[model samples]
Target: MTTDLVERVRHRLAGESRGTDPIALAEAVRAEAGGALSHDAVLAAVRQARDEFVGAGPLAPLLEDDTITDVLVTAPDEVWTDGPLGLSQTTIRFPDEDAVRRLAQRLALAAGRRLDDAQPYVDGWLPARQGRIRVHAVLPPIAANGTCLSLRVLRPVTHDLAALQAHGCIDATALSILQAILKHRLAFLVTGGTGAGKTTLLSALLGAVAPTERIVCVEDAGELRPTHPQFVSLVARPANVEGAGAVELPELVRQALRMRPDRLVVGEVRGAEVCSLLNAMNTGHDGGACPLTELIRVFLQVRRVAASFPCHAFSG
Candidate 1:
């Protein structure tokens, strides 16, 4: 299909039956742009229109691919994906940079965030219908090049200790050690870099907790999925453009403290929330867990170890 035809179809379809009926809309668009497009190209054009205006546009297919763990849009012509085999580029492309910008802005809005020149970047977790994507979008001033959208596919992988062992996320020795940590009620942190299976590992460990134990998890994006029956989760919320309502992790940590939690879980420690979490730990909130990005900095502040501790930390 020609660009002119696609544009014409998009313009006409922007009304009443745009996304509600893709099939009928596609048929109508194909008829409207007839004679010029080849028989095979007509169907392609139809599907393209459906993808463009009706759905997530170019990103629906990528999001549907279970193997793809991430989708990176560096530019309109440049799209990359990271799967089990690792990062690689794909053939997905938009008409221009503006299309990418529109898609990014729509995703942010769909997730109840505001993104524009005033706020060049946004960070939030999409609803389940949007594939539960963790979104971080940047515009020209902050991005240098153009609009860039980074989406992390948070697939449901709340595995148990044995499942982690089966998937090689942890060796048998590590699994045994992790179970011992839970059994003994030792307070420890999961120190690892991004995409290092830190959240996956921590979720598995939380699953091993006793059913009777009450666990509360505070996160920026609600990434952790614990199998424990009594798991309670709280996610941070960003303030609007007016800057009236904003809820941070530290406040959630304080809120979780008064709820009589047997164990507390923080998805990541980024700021004063760490101080509150540490204070709670010192006050005997044992078996708490958090992913510390800078493993070195965390250890540098640990002045001493237990006189006769039974567990050792694992680093990878």
Candidate 2:
């Protein structure tokens, strides 16, 4: 019945009938086909179909607003956006939790992903109809309150180092320091809290490297976007429902080492790969770095190993 309804709507939309309201078209089709579709049902079905076809939702307009950084959905009726000014509630609603779930599932499936009670949660990038989609969803049991969603939109273009310097993410001195660090091939760590501009700083720093050099970046979530020419990126994956296969971050790090990378970048080290990264740096893979805490762990671990190895020491 759903498939037939969808086909009918598609035909109506494709026919370009003048002065026909889409909801009305859907209702007429539903009545002709003897399907139980109300005005609200027709409206919802049309919106879903349109979003699936075009890849953008009604929220697409708000998502395109450059001033907004985050879109928070507390419930179908409550929506809020955060930006430089502050948080301001928007006039967007889902009608109910089921509507929200349907929209979430449609968007997820359109992105070649899944979202449902069994999985209950999803976190990944969504290819937007007009822009990028960073979506997170939580379902019941795990989410006793209800399913929650947060969407972050990435700008179509990225900023360069000079631009960042202008924004105070880095000053001239810090920029020069980073250049020297990259030039001397010294291994350094970039530390900061979440949303503290770690990846952005790393990307800008990587951009300063000589274009002739090859950089291999391994990430679990694939967030780093470097501007350098000779760059290779490897993203890790989780196991499927059947548990057939999975590619982990540590494994990717190990693999990147073998790819003859002039510089190895691991985006946000969070696991046993710390040992491998330290080994790589200690073994002459200079310019190795990750997020600050990971770097500190690596530094402390390296120092501990050095103290134990006796002959192993880092020379200034």
Candidate 3:
């Protein structure tokens, strides 16, 4: 049967033949079988043998390791991983630069992007193995040393509001203040330095919203996952290889406004879109909220305007 033929070929290839030619191996197997298979069948068996050998590469096992948060490769021989403790060296090695280049190209292609000498660098999220892959690579004169690669592995969500409270991210007074802000539909911003739990506070406030009202979120990295019934999420996209197609957060914000959102949330405001957001808030979009940096800027702008003129004159 064809199944038995396939298995026989696999078994023969699995042995330590030490770089035996596939055609020679197949011909030997056919000769022992009393010429049962034709020449074309032997060639087909040889091709399958070669494919099975190369397809059993080691990338799958490395990706499956949960503790490995990142994978780094400066060259084919140098591989490393960064996890909970810190960066540790890895045993995984590629045969040569060509091998590393091939794997990088495959990963980039799988992520719907391209990688090559012309476009020697790429950054994107790739859905492969166990978790998402954040790939960055540099080649040749730009790299100086050699081709470099870094991958960031993202884990699943596991924490909730109670957990955040336990970590002192929110106190009773702060919690109450957030609730009042949400309840009264007052526009507010939660500001903090990097890694200061800005997104965490935003997620908690969004979680406090009424389940019936619709909430639209626009983000660049798709990190905000608010626990609400009526929620819609949109993520932006970078330009393609040709630099023709791209979708940005501001465009998504404009589209989200047209969707009749009861509440609008932007994950981060770092560009001209702040002007659009300010216009929206000042023009009856009361409940809109963003991070604290923006909130402080608006507050300072208002304070400067008040200080510039007399109180009675401002009232008039």
Instruction: Choose the strongest candidate by lDDT.
Output: 1
Candidate 1, RMSD to the unseen true structure: 4.8
TM-score (all chains, Cα) for each model: 0.83, 0.77, 0.67
Tens-digit lDDT string for candidate 1 (280-315): 776778888888888776555442332223433321
lDDT of each: 0.79, 0.71, 0.68
Q: Over the stretch 184-287, how does candidate 2's per-residue lDDT look in tens digits?
A: 88766778776667877888778777998899988766667778898798987766545447788878888999999898888876666766676666677777
Q: Estimate, for each residue in 1-316, the C-alpha lDDT of model 3 and write its tens digit.
A: 2445544654655563645476656754574456877888777656544433442144555566898867888887898887777888878776566556656766666666778878888887776545456677766667777778777765433355666778887777877776788888877766878546687778877877889889888877666766788879888887877876789877888888888888888778777566556555544565777775556665565454445443311110
Per lDDT, what order, best first?
1, 2, 3
Candidate 1 off by > 4 Å: 1-19, 27-42, 129-131, 298-316
Q: How far in Å is the alpha carbon of 305 misplaced in model 1?
A: 17
Worst 10 residues of 3 by lDDT: 307-316
**Stronger candidate by lDDT (1 vs 3):** 1
